[model samples]
Target chain A: MIDVIHPSLLLFLGAAIVPLLRGRAQQAWMLLLPAAIIAVVFSLPHGSSGAMNLFGMDLLILRIDALSMVFTSVFAIITFVGALYALHVKDTTQHVAALTYAGSALGVVLAGDLITLYVFWELMVFTSVWLIWCRRNPVSMAAGFRYLIVHALGGVILLAGIILHVMDTGSVAFTAIDPDSAGFYLILIGFMINAAVPPLHAWLTDAYPESTITGAIFLASLTTKTAVYTLIRGFPGTELLVVLGVIMALYGVVYAVLANDIRRLLAYHIISQVGYMVAGVGMGTIMALNGSASHAFTHILYKAVLFMGAGAVIHMTGKAKLTELGGIYRYMPITFLLYMVGGLSISAFPLFSGFVSKTMVVEAAALDGRAWVWLLLSLASAGTFLHTGLKLPWFTFFGQDSGLRPKEAPLNMLLAMGIAAFLCIFIGVFPGWLYAIMPAPVEYNAYSTGHVLWELQLLLFTGLGFFFLLKHVGGEAKISVDTDWLYRWLLPKFALGVQRVVDRVWDAVLGGLMRRLTWLVSSLTHHHGPQGILARTWPTGSMVLWVAVMLAASLLLYYL
Target chain B: MDLGRLLEYLVENARVLRWFAYVVMAGLVVADILIPSAYDRFPWESIGGFGAFYGFISCVLIIVISKALGYLLLYRGEDYYDD
Candidate 1:
């Protein structure tokens, strides 16, 4: 008898039934599934399950441990929250896609083998692409295809690595990989692509803003966090990741400076935020790893809240660009207030969730005697406050009026944001609640006098800089090109160039050959035609005479 | 009180809020000087208001550099991709 049901299984089952039901029943079922999954996840014991010997390889389907439990628990909660925020959406396809996309993400976190992980990884791509496509616009269509292609390429690289890894080790278990192993870099690249490490990160900022308003929340929450989970599980203590992570941290903040779209700005911050988790995974100390895990946990909640707030504004006003918005605080004060909680939490302000988790990694860097890493990470944190905390909210809700006063978000959306905001503050206030669930013992105190004073000084000063430069920081009616420009613009143009050359070559070489062949065919047909000299009415008589002559010659030759 | 009215009230008293921010910032600097941290890992971290200076400078530099980069390489018309 099965004592533990995989949470993903429940979500997948719910997704199938979603399209069959309608109206309030479907909505209730959607909410019920995530709630039940949360219960199931909590009930799950710390061990492997669904073990089987497939083709002489042991396949562990469900591996529950301290690390995975932390990720899955948060994932389940966000699924429920995301579902609630999406309650106003009437599109059943969006509902089904959201559920399955979430289920696949849970599947990835719960997977014990690389094979199982890869299957769910690809499932996540296919199912989640619908969220972008569900917007049903040309831009989304193009963005969705690009998202699909990029992930497909990443999936192929991962599959190649997994095959080689299994060949070298004769095991498919997902664990810490030896760097010198044949598949190490291949697998790392694949994970890094999903992690949205720059150069490999364009797919995220490209497609997310184009996704449907409800879909953007799930899009923001799941994909990269799962990638962080894999990086933590697989490539802990990678020194290269340390460098890459820091670059990612600053890279996102730098790019966010140019983001005009509200969702796109938040999307870049996801990269900035995930950079902290990646850096922690690279540090690889118990404190650092714990920090990474807890950060991912807090991050999922806070980021969901942030996305929900942004989505709410877009939902009501149908405007997503920061340049096109302002003075809506009077119209939507609750959203402004709730969004502030997320902003403060992300900025690591005192008594916020980020303070508890982000500092652990930065502290780990300090303890390790890496001053540059610590300082750079701190700078990135300042940048975080500058963008997500100050610039976004200032221009979006509180800046000079754009003369648009849209109504507040719907009831369900506000409630979802409210729940997430409560968690952010609750975790901020009593970090013990979050600490108890960490993968390791929590020894650090976020409320210590020194840490709080330093954080306040850093964030508040950044706020001052924002006000001073208020004239310059407002969103412009322009976009900043990222790595996507390579594929979206350069690659297509290059392909067209290649196609023109090929066409000319075909015309010169194959076309000439075709002309010759055509002439030969016509010549042969002309000679062999019924009206030709060779095919006249006398052909039968000539044939008989030639046959008789040949017979006589053969008889004379035989006699001789 | 309604949240809108509260916000409106704060906005109307923007001067007071601005002064409040400046005063808090000043207080934080003094606190940093008075209360030395046991957890200061770097030499500069022990300096009063190092964080404040760095935060301000970093914010300014980030804005200047990002704007420069944007103007030089990144910024394009909104329809840059459509073509």
Candidate 2:
């Protein structure tokens, strides 16, 4: 065993003290802590170490494989970026909460056992909520509470699955699982909720957009990435995910098309992009899984870029709805350009990072001879192009010129987006840098002529479709329908109905109970005459009458 | 020319245009099967042709019907949650 602990965890745990110190120390917590933690995480002991026994099976927590390495690197990068984004805030509660959250995610990646993983997993839920509530608005507080309920439910489900899985196979090892048991299925569902899978996707858009600006940036970076990590560990290669993946791909596109809030639109597309990863895992090929990891890594980068662009707009304009905001791109050109690369990357445009990685999943599907899935993927591709690829930037940055002049985003924000933008194109132009670091050996070429041609044709044709239907699809109105409409709308409606029934029942029962008590008391204390027994003194006539009545009863009994 | 005749004249016969467009769509779909792809493989898939055509048609039909009903049943106003 190594002595004095792994350096990353040491630095990360060490940084927890920074926020606790006095004034200047708080700022130091934001700046230096991330720098120190990243350095330490980058220096972890490489390769898979021996698995430690947890529950019953050997657990590999410190596996520095290609798969885990990409996420660990980006996870650390986001902490720094999210810190820079949130540095303006003075709230120590949010600062410490955010740092601990970033540290928890780091620990999860380095964890070797299921118990260790679960420990970090639950820590993530509690800390992330404080970041949201830092906005200190009634709506935000409510949204934070709603987010907590859902996350708590996810934690409970995951805990049950982990416990049952351990008991069943006598193994708490994290690896690919067969979907043959209640435990396995519950765990998949749990991960999918964090993944923002269907009917439950609303919490993401509902909460993230409502949090304080810096709070949103931190909220965007970590939660989904951690969920993607757990999914990669637990449910790689399961067939049912193919169906869920396809549904998410299309669902994101359709809802995104209708969404008016800029961040919510991006949030929907987050689910859409994760579909590529989920489908990749379902394909179960090594290439596909690698592609998923690559996609997740790139997605976090570009998505952060997108959210920052959005945050910049909200920073300046104080508006996020499409109707109220436009033409601000003229004011913030640097931010606009940075955001464009992110958008293009997510759309899987040729030579962008998305094109290089997403194809592997598609190729794996074809290799597996699942033609229907291929068609669904193509349709989702068309939708992605229609909604996010062409629609997001075209309308926001280059649309009917809303003529609203907002100042450029702050220096650090622009710098962060620029860094992400450079990576988007860098990985697109030279995918080898990423390919070199994939979880598996790289043997695939994303530059094939057929592949390039088909993608261009698909994206171009979808763009053509968008122009044709812009009239039907265009409007400033925010459409409030998604998996979220269920919890946000339907759940409350159902609760109101149940409450009405309960109120009526309770009122009737209590009313009857009050009446019966009154009736019983009245009967017990009745007085027959004007002079009651206790009100007047006892007279001689009354005593004599009582004795005469007794004598008469005795004589009557003797005669009988 | 009268208004109807003027419209027809500018469009080159309305019925003729509709029929022409329909014919062209059918032609492209038919050409897909007859023309040899560069790989010498006809991309015409035979995996339950109804699944490609009529299954989709039925699914669309059901959705349209269900959505029409849900529109009336599940409608909520703008301020439902705000208050």
Considering the two chains of model 1, state its CAPRI-style docking category: medium
A1-560: candidate 1 lDDT, tens digit per residue = 33578788888888999989889998898789888888888889998888878888777779999889998988888888999998978899999999999999989999999999999999999999999999999999999999999999999999999988989998999999888778999999999999999889999999999999889888888999999999999999998888888999999999889999988999999999899899989989888888889888888888888898888888888888888999899999999999999999999998889989999889889888889889999999999999989898998899989898888889999999999999999999999998898878888888888888889999999999989999999899999999999999899999999999999998899989999999997787788777656665776888999999999999999999
Error (Å) of candidate 1 at residue A268 is 0.5
Model 1 residue pairs with clashes = none
Q: Write the per-residue lDDT of candidate 1 for residues B1-74, one digit (tens) a residue.
A: 29999999999999999999999999999999898766767888889888899899989989999999999999
Error at B69, model 2, angstroms: 12
Clashing pairs in 2: A61-A111, A61-A112
- The regions of model 1 sitting more than 4 angstroms off are A510-560
| i-RMSD of model 1 (Å, 1 decimal) | 0.8
Q: After superposition, how far is residue A542 of candidate 1 from its true place, in Å?
A: 26
| DockQ, Cα level, model 2 | 0.04
Q: TM-score for all predictions?
A: 0.93, 0.82
- State how far residue A269 of model 1 sits from its true place (Å): 0.5
